[model samples]
Target chain A: MRKNRSPKPPEPCLLTECMQVIAGAWAPNVIWSLRAGPRRFNELKTDIPPVSSKVLSARLSELEERGVLVRHVRPTSPPSVEYELTALGEELIPALEAIVEVGHKLKQLRGYEPASEAAE
Target chain B: MRKNRSPKPPEPCLLTECMQVIAGAWAPNVIWSLRAGPRRFNELKTDIPPVSSKVLSARLSELEERGVLVRHVRPTSPPSVEYELTALGEELIPALEAIVEVGHKLKQLRGYEPASEAAE
Candidate 1:
């Protein structure tokens, strides 16, 4: 005979945890920059100019801890460290794209040029 | 003849602006809560219990200012006010769904039960 299963309790709030991972001035920018590809610490710093090295490092570490990013160290002549989005992190790109699209739409509605059109 | 147009400068980063909109402890939850339908202030408070009244009001006002939600004051005895997602805000639901999916996946990888599965 098949056994009946009891309903499970709701999992601890993952949405709030995900939001915490992305909440911060530098975390989003860092994640956005990495969407193209992995980058060294210096490269990330250069790509996101307004962020200081200190803040960037902190954000990177936080993201890594959250499993959104993975750190790699290359054993070359000099050891080089790089950071890239994990599979979980890649999953967030579509969401970010959607957010960007909506943001552009809002800007257009408010009489500002949409970002994509403004890039034309 | 069509005029030759120079490529326009990249519009001020919309991604960052969008990130700013969703980046907060309560903002994502508030946005997610409205996904089903509009909610009055008290309704929202009950939906997201951990948030205090003062913080919820502040977040709702901030979301309204950011154009993510619209506040409608009902013409009633007590003048009930309801908050609903704008078109732009509705656009964010898919993104939030994607985030939640990834969040669940990450939780599973970490040996925690996925939220949906746990709810079953």
Candidate 2:
């Protein structure tokens, strides 16, 4: 779900603030899952197998609080909940991909594992 | 000092570890400063004015411990020290810039302050 296009100019040296928010333990994974568009909580947990329900719920809440993701509730009989990226959250895709690119490269440099893309 | 060029493919769905490591309060700033090359502890503190000495020291140590940076000690008359990105650390530049790009866009969407680059 990560967006991989677009190479923009060097940003202000002060962007560490953005990094701090997205750097949370489950934030990146949540962002990546949302890249495919909005999904229900169970779908998200399915896509990202390791995150516990409580932790995922907490992370979703935190991302919403940080303006990174939006949570929606549908007025169904039992109530359905969905999570999606807000404009702010979608904007993070490129940056997160950039980090992934670096991770891929580091893996190559360390002779560890090649990036999923490179392996394919 | 954030690297702005090079847009590679989207990485595996599991790069949150790298983000977590660099997402510390002072870590991004430290990475930005180190992008130009190595610097002494005091120089880092000067470039990123908000961080305290203890925090900077702790962040640098944390980054070094995470394999993102290297600390070098010089046997100067007064004992000098320097910190630089390890290969892994240097590799983070593009990803960091990517995050900055997202931040810039978010600012645009939210009607918040523009990225430093656009302001310049």
Best by DockQ: 1
lDDT, candidate 1, A1-120, per-residue tens: 212122211332677766666766677777777887777888777667789988988888778876778999999777878899987777677666766776676566655322232332
- What clash pairs does model 1 have? none
Residue-level error in angstroms, candidate 2, position B2: 43
Candidate 2, residues A44-118, lDDT tens digits: the string is 776667789998988887787677788899998778798888777878888877777776676566564222234
TM-score versus the correct structure, for each prediction: 0.74, 0.75
Off by over 4 Å in 1: A1-14, A75-79, A112-120, B1-12, B75-78, B112-120
Candidate 1 lDDT score at position B17: 71
Window of ten residues with lowest summed lDDT in model 2 chain A: A1-10
Provide the TM-score, chain A, model 1.
Answer: 0.74
How big is the positional error of residue A77 in model 2, measured in Å on the Cα after superposition? 4.4
Q: What are the clashing pairs of model 2?
A: A95-B98, A95-B99, A98-B95
Query: What tens-digit string does per-residue lDDT give for candidate 2 at B1-120?
Result: 222122222443537656666766778878877887788877777677789999998898778766788899999887879898987787888877776767666656656523223432
Query: Alpha-carbon error at B32 in model 2, in Å?
Result: 1.3
Q: TM-score of A-chain in each prediction?
A: 0.74, 0.74
